[model samples]
Target: MKLPSEFIEKMERLLEDEASRFFSTYHEEKANGLRFNPLKIDRETFLTLVPFALSPVPFCPTGFYYDAHEQPGKHPYHAAGLYYIQEPSAMFVAEVLKPNPGEFVLDLCAAPGGKTTQLAAMMKNQGLIIANEIHPKRVKALSENIERFGITNALVTNETPEKLAKYFPGFFDKILVDAPCSGEGMFRKDEEAVQFWSQAHVEQCAIKQRHILDCAYEMLKEGGILVYSTCTFSPEENEQTIEAFLQTYDDLELLSIEKVHGIQPGRREWTNTNFEEMERTARLWPHSLKGEGHFVAKIKKTGPSPSWNGRYAKPNASKQMVREYRQFEQEVLQTEIEKPMYAFQHHLFALPDHCPNFDGLKVVRAGLHLGEAKKQRFEPNHALALSLKPQDVRYSLDLSSDSVECLKYLRGETIQTGEDRGWLLVTVDGYPLGWGKEVKGMVKNFYPKGLRIN
Candidate 1:
């Protein structure tokens, strides 16, 4: 890996004794970690199912580390949305943010929806969470993950962070800026990232990080919290960039995150620059810990800012889209699903009331996603579909040894649950397995084909 002269020079000046060790070798193995979704399953139950080689990550109660001998993805638990594959250090940012129920939040660069789903689980499917990913291609994965985890209170949007600030100024109670950075920290996991390593790349990433932070700050309401995080380990992109932002905006003060486990506070002094006051910021080193490198800082907006002056307009959806959504709710859901699903920039959503307030702001998502309703019946969304409790349904399978294993494995094959015919909810000791319509003494499988275990 070729380090930039300026970055290398900066590192030498910053770490007079440690400079040689910093850039000499590359650790090329991927860190192993997973985050549990508390919304669908409890910690104790999940731990019992994991392989012994995989141990709980001490820093995060919900996170775990496993040996690479087996593919966790191939496990039935993965198909159940029991956990998410994530870099261990990256897990801390969302935990530190601590988004509660009934608070408006944004994940500026949410994709593959790891942190976004974590935030949703923390919020307990209550409160509004807008997950914005700029790339259109990544939205599918983001949307699918949200559904897989049974999230009922998120609005997934495809837009840049700047566009979000324009539509919602002083709107969210909390915002997460997991900014895109040069893949320095990801070198171990992605060889392509190493191939692109250069001083020019680092400098370019620093510029983008600063821009992203600026936009995150603008979208935060007075007294709102903004959590800035990155997967890279560059002062230019981490401490230095934050210091520059502080100089420009005195109202944005750094707050300590001492409560989180598995993290050390940021260095009070970097290079020749001493920052005794900035210790509130946090940094995670892969070498120091069991995970990859990461940086997280919590900032609070103090003082009033000008009201957001952007034009507000209801999201316009094709009549066909609206009809499809409603028809599915009426027929398939059977229950009266919520209405006037929030719309934003050509998208429409329905969320439970537990979601946070969207009044006086541009709503990017609204309502519990009930999947798309169509043809007088509803097609269950992976989100709502995953949370269906067998007890909620009129018909269900009896708790048997084979039944339990089958459900746990997420096998597509149907089983006798003692139901004669009609819709039946499958369960393992009373957990929901979406819905299945039964006929001729057998239930038609409603488990999503893509989500079934191998």
Candidate 2:
């Protein structure tokens, strides 16, 4: 738990009288939190269903604080897209830039999808949200979380902010740049942040954040909201960076963020010119709250922007593939997929509403992946199963959360259903777990291999 000597010195200078309280928090156990998915279950039901003792995160209604000893990540409900484990302070970032249903949104630098999932849930999975990450490897985790959340309206991509800006100029109604930082706020949660702490690194992160913000501003339409956030408490990357950004763009205006539940305002004294309007931004200090540190700033674009002329994605699935999928849908699903069907070779996907043509972008996941076309028949993807309710399918095998059968299913073991139902949805406490295919009194597990628990 030893902090960098230079970082300690810097914080002591920054906090002055309050430095003692801030340093003392490091000795205490870090707070843990998770937000229930409203897309799948309601707050009251989730409260009754989950076994862990939980308390509400004051800033976010769906967010809850769990004990450090609890492991909600290992639960079957987690795999069923019931909730997402996240940092309490991190949950507040999406609340600042809450996007409405049917609004086009962008989560620039979205990876491991903590904030993106929250935003999508707020939107009720109705809008088209582009979750973009620059790193190839990180984008995969982002896609998996999006899938696990059963989010059907997100277009997960692996592309640089610069490239995205060029293609989606003035296209988004709202944007979130949860820019990468020096990890000062995440030090308590991740020790690597403490090891990597340096004044030079903070300065470098500030430069990168500003550039990412510039790109995010380009994609946002006139009168659109752009929320910039970081996990670091460094003024160089928070107040000072926002000050420089506001100075650069005349049309940009800093909007006031409601400082509730021990949340503090951005320090104007931390800026180069003592920018008085810096108070509009918000800071979540570890000592002042029940979670790790974070900084958030919401801005509005007042200048006019060119209207986006991008083409909407077209349905490209062949008649044969469609017929096979339709047959599978009729025999298996009680409900039908009415969205535009898109094909990627043998695989098929149900494109999101008003999905744009992602011709050149490195799309990791395009909306809801329907399934794959195999020979004369169609096989459903695990994503398709997770996206459905038990009532949506004809047959299902419901298993209790703590039962050995649930563990067996999660471990990719075949279950003895003793029913000849061709396709069945597997569930844990009435929530869709994954897909299973039945032949003669035996259900072959279709749970994804990579996700199987050993």
Which candidate tops TM-score? 2
Name model 2 segments beyond 4 Å from true: none
Tens-place lDDT per residue, model 2, 324-365, is: 999999999999989999998999999999999999999989
Give the whole-model CA lDDT for all candidates, comma-separated: 0.71, 0.94
Instruction: Give the C-alpha lDDT of model 1.
Output: 0.71
Candidate 1 lDDT over 232-297, as tens digits, reads 877777887788777779898888887455576777675226777567888886645777778888
Error of 2 at 34 (Å): 0.4
Instruction: State in Å the error of residue 445, model 2.
Output: 0.4
